[model samples]
Target: MSFTLPTPTAAERNRLARLFAQIASDAGTRVMEVYESNFETRTKADYSPVSDADERAEEVILARLEQDLPGIPVLAEERASREGVGGQIWDAFILVDPVDGTKEFIQRKGDFTVNIALICGGYTVAGAVFAPARREMYLGGGAAEVFEGFLPGETVTQGQKLVTRAYPPEGLTAITSASHLDERTKAFLAARKIAGQTAIGSSLKFCWVAAGKADVYPRWGPTMEWDTAAGHAVLNAAGGVVTQPDGAPFVYGKGGEGFRNGPFIAWGREPV
Candidate 1:
């Protein structure tokens, strides 16, 4: 697939931001409507959990993105394969995870999120994770200071900033999915001698590192590009490393190829 234009202008940027924010907020509304309800969930062929909330939220996202940014292509979770959109090595694309932490959402754990990322030149320039269940949004990139805005309330000022908690050395606090931590990730942590671990869901794992709430996140399980792009942008903006142990920077636009990342780490500071 051919790449789109370069970085968007201030006006265009704001438009995209607002569109994404609107979609995310709408998704929140859709999810919260059923957050406490008895929405049914079913197992995918791979045994992954999915609910109507996921499909509905993705529909809202796809509609808004297509209407607002017609030129830009969307890689939404539900539309990935149906659209025949994942094979090409495009220069730019919109990566979306309509409902991450589906298990958390299903269990009413309030850790689910809607993750969106702008991938260009094989890197995430703008990413946002809206935890609608918790009414918190982690938005970073496009400028300094990872902004954490509480929902239906205040907003982030253009100039004021937030940075990661200083990287810790006493013991690394790793974050994992409460219900989805796989055996490979567990073994990797155990063999690598990670000092401690905590469990949360969705892109919050990346936010944990960005906010200095935690130090590192190691995962060996299979993850689609949407799952990490937004979080990756936030962590990178906060002066953190989202790279392989071999020291190469994480690159996107690989689709189902390019190793899709294996046993990588998101560190708040230099590894010891």
Candidate 2:
């Protein structure tokens, strides 16, 4: 079934979309500002790279969301591990990844983005992905928008309507993390004999699939809910599936345990 964002009226949907787009754009600005600056990169405890942009972008996104849509739970990457915030057992809430491609941003590749997803019940009702460095914004799936803006933060006029491509003949083209590829994914690929592959950073992996650029993404390495939530929502709206290997739906409220996601695959349709 096609997914849809929950909104009382077209006006309300448009209003929320505009606000979400702006918040994404602002977060993009904060990220780019740090991108332009000479910031030192540090390895996290797990050896994944992080920068000032990551923290700043989360701050910007969270601050605006709190002001703009208070009372709704916010499950942010940075705050997800904190004592009182990460365990989001909300009937409705926002899931955000402030700076999705920290590695690409650090490498100056400009493939990063600000990802936001709104969840209703246990599913992604709507999602927005803004790739600032590229000056493109992709929305819809459960909710429909494709837009390009002239300036870094100009108005996002709509573009082509996007949908996930049909599944591939020789199995799907899968995208994986640049830094976190692990044995489980390798084994899955080997056992499945999936040949085509691409490596990407941040939530753009999900955006790629949502935009019909790729068909699958399998992550076997460590990931928190925030790391996948926004992208998961985007994929979900785009006629895709993001599920635990056990065949259970990936639910939130995992608590402040930080890394929680095991291996999961996202695809245009359910993979055989």
Candidate 3:
């Protein structure tokens, strides 16, 4: 059966955002456990690396999602890699990337994250991203109700509300992917008057822009919905925008493309 739950109210969206943050924190703890251990890595059918941390953390996220928000479909990375999500359009669903930035996780770079997002009507309505090793958590929902917090235990506390900064007159500070920087991305940056750039793995690029740590993030390479949905939601709530190269709205639920994502640019604020 197709699951098409109605979008939650603004109050409910904020509540779900916090709930997602807690869930991401729980999954992140499991990821950290695997990170600290002697973990084994294997290559997926697509030749991308998958580690025990990915699977273990996904287990936590899936279990929690099932308990907290039952009946909603979940499109998770690990499970999707194993059992492909058939071509079924969904009006609403959850996207989970239990251990985003596996390369960073494998390299012990501490840039990996646990991501959970709620997508409704082809938009990311709520999301949470937790970087356990960095002790950071970000949540977004409602209109401009984005927050960043520290997770000391199972809860996220002392949340500092976040908003995207205005574009600086000097130039843009761009964030790029550490592992997937392609020529098209390089060419895109080369054309811009960039003041500085930082390369990081996973969804942190979107969070950096949302937090106003950077002005833009341009990815010309391939990504999956689970890779961008949560971060996109956080950025959107923080007064940022993510769109196509031509400035079109970036949308989700591309079941025809097998949930794969096209290149998109995320901006802290529109440049003049």
Candidate 4:
């Protein structure tokens, strides 16, 4: 129930990022292989869909995290649900969403991603998201400023550093969840002055905003801590912000809500 927290030194952070990127990329590959095959989907207790890909990918990532990081605790989506980690508090831990955007993955939308993050002091220190179907991977936070490129491997370098563009002078460009869009989101956009919008699935919205492809992503519906932690870190590393409606920084470790997130906005710039 207790362990020494890893020091967040620069070298240590880089090592962690490399290990995490490899894990994410491997997990993503597993997901894509499943995507290419005839996969079955089953409904979970929460009525959300789960597939063989989710379990297989999480098992791969979890085993690596456990073997490599030893004492560091991990709060992965599939395992945590059965282990009840969502209801416990930890000073530092790894949060993993082995497959985000399951609905998109099931639908073959190619919007799903494999997410892994290090959360310390209620903030994500580093994170990585790999979209195998899209052949793209993003890593950010801590010593690694946000970056995007193919997943790190034998040939590719780390990646190009990512920076969110300045709020467009013309107007704001927003991206919303392709499948989860609701009236509240539309109303939020209507009330605000925005020029255009894009609908994409999964945590890719956060990556788009972080990569300067969009300005803001407002989510008024429910999400879990695992759903946003990795993407939140990527956005933050690229000079973006994710905050509650009241504009406070969105921190994790929400044991009270069982790690479920309330509505929040991921902005390319600090909201005025």
Candidate 5:
């Protein structure tokens, strides 16, 4: 017997977006609780940092997801690295980064976020990202339109619609990582004649670009699928594009490649 994936109806997609917003918000609250306390931090095997907030927030997210959407496989950052996700030919699955900026969280910077994305057919169908510290959340993809605001307890219908701005003729405004800026990134900006650059943390860069607050985000460093999926969905819905340096569409479900993402550029508007 062969198994098949069920396609989500429009109503289901809208409902799923709301559920994802709630779940990501719940995870963000857990992170914020740890952020306010004397939390312990440690280095992972990959030399990247992980804090109590990361683990605890993921726990909260996984628990709720399991309860609310049973049988759906979840590829979460901490859990997937610890216990490998089984090789199931899933047509739909959840990708989550419970705490996307552990370093920023540890440093008391309000730039960390909680991310939840639903990938089906190798594309992000629905997603929600919450920055509890900033009281901002972004939701989009699938049947939902891109939107952002105080969205933890609110639905997409209540949030403000987001759209990308036109590319300015003077130069481009770029957002980059606050802690992980590499020379390649600097060179990319220099070559593009960037008008300005802002250093930020987590998937907020993608959200800012989606909301027309910024013009572009160029990432030259390595990243995981969970690190960008949710934001990618939001940006994609907001009239933006995330593509490789060669202008190929950024895609997901690269389990064969260890779910690693190559360098990509997210554009607020099509660039010449």
Candidate 6:
């Protein structure tokens, strides 16, 4: 028999956001442990890099999720790599990327992050992202207002509410992937009057726009649902919108396509 999971209430969503932040932060600690050491890296079947940091961090997140939310299905990177996530349409589930920017982590660029997001009805309902090396954490969804915090130590410092900035009269500033910029993305930007552009690693591109540090992030390259979900949730909560190149909705849970994501543009505010 098939069962659909119910969406969390507003208060429950806020609690889950807090829980997810802590989970991501805890996993980030494991990630930092490997980052500080002489870590060994290996390539996955898909040719993407994976490291001890990724495995260790994923272990932390999986353990916590199993303890707290046992019934909900989890689609995590490391585990999914080992055992393919068979075709199943879930009404609600968790997406976890123990280390979102593995390349950055391997290169010691300090832009990698631990991501965890709750997806309900093919939409991100709550999420958390923790960049351990950068000492920053962001959380949003449901009743909880989008906010960012610093984690120089064990606990997160006070969180400051976040809101996407209005599109400036000046030309737009775009954030693109440092490692994955492609011809299509270049052409997309070329067609616009952009004031500046910044290339960085990981889902932080979405957070950049969410924090109003940049105006838009357009990606024509490939991505996984897990790679974008948490950042998408945070951006959505911050008054931003992520949609297709033509401004259609971008929904998740594409099991048939192996959970891959197509090109999408993230805007701080929809252009008038």
Which candidate has the top score in lDDT?
3
* Candidate 1: worst-modelled 10 consecutive residues by lDDT: 152-161
Better of 2 and 4 by lDDT: 4
Expressed as tens digits, the lDDT of each residue in 96-136 for candidate 3 is 99988999999999999899999999999889888888877
| lDDT for each candidate structure | 0.71, 0.71, 0.86, 0.82, 0.81, 0.85
Q: Give the alpha carbon lDDT tens digit for every residue of 84-157 in model 1.
A: 45357777788988888888888788888887778877878777777876767666664434334555223433
lDDT of 6: 0.85
Ranking by lDDT: 3, 6, 4, 5, 2, 1
- The total number of steric clashes, by the backbone 3 Å criterion, in model 1 comes to 0
Against the hidden reference, what TM-scores do the models get? 0.84, 0.83, 0.94, 0.92, 0.89, 0.93
Off by over 4 Å in 2: 1-18, 42-49, 80-88, 148-151, 193-195, 256-259
Writing each residue's lDDT as its tens digit, candidate 4 over 94-135 gives 899989999999999888988998888898877888888887
lDDT of 6 by residue, 84-178 (tens): 87777998999999999999999999999889999999988788888889987887775324334455235543367878998888889999999
Which 10-residue window of candidate 6 scores lowest in summed lDDT? 143-152
Name every residue pair that clashes in candidate 5. Answer: none
Task: Report the poorest 10 consecutive residues by lDDT, candidate 3.
Answer: 143-152
Clashes of each: 0, 3, 0, 0, 0, 0
Return whichever of 3 and 5 wins on TM-score: 3
Worst 10 residues of 2 by lDDT: 1-10
Can you give the lDDT of residue 125 in candidate 1?
A: 74
Rate residue 127 of model 5 by lDDT. 83
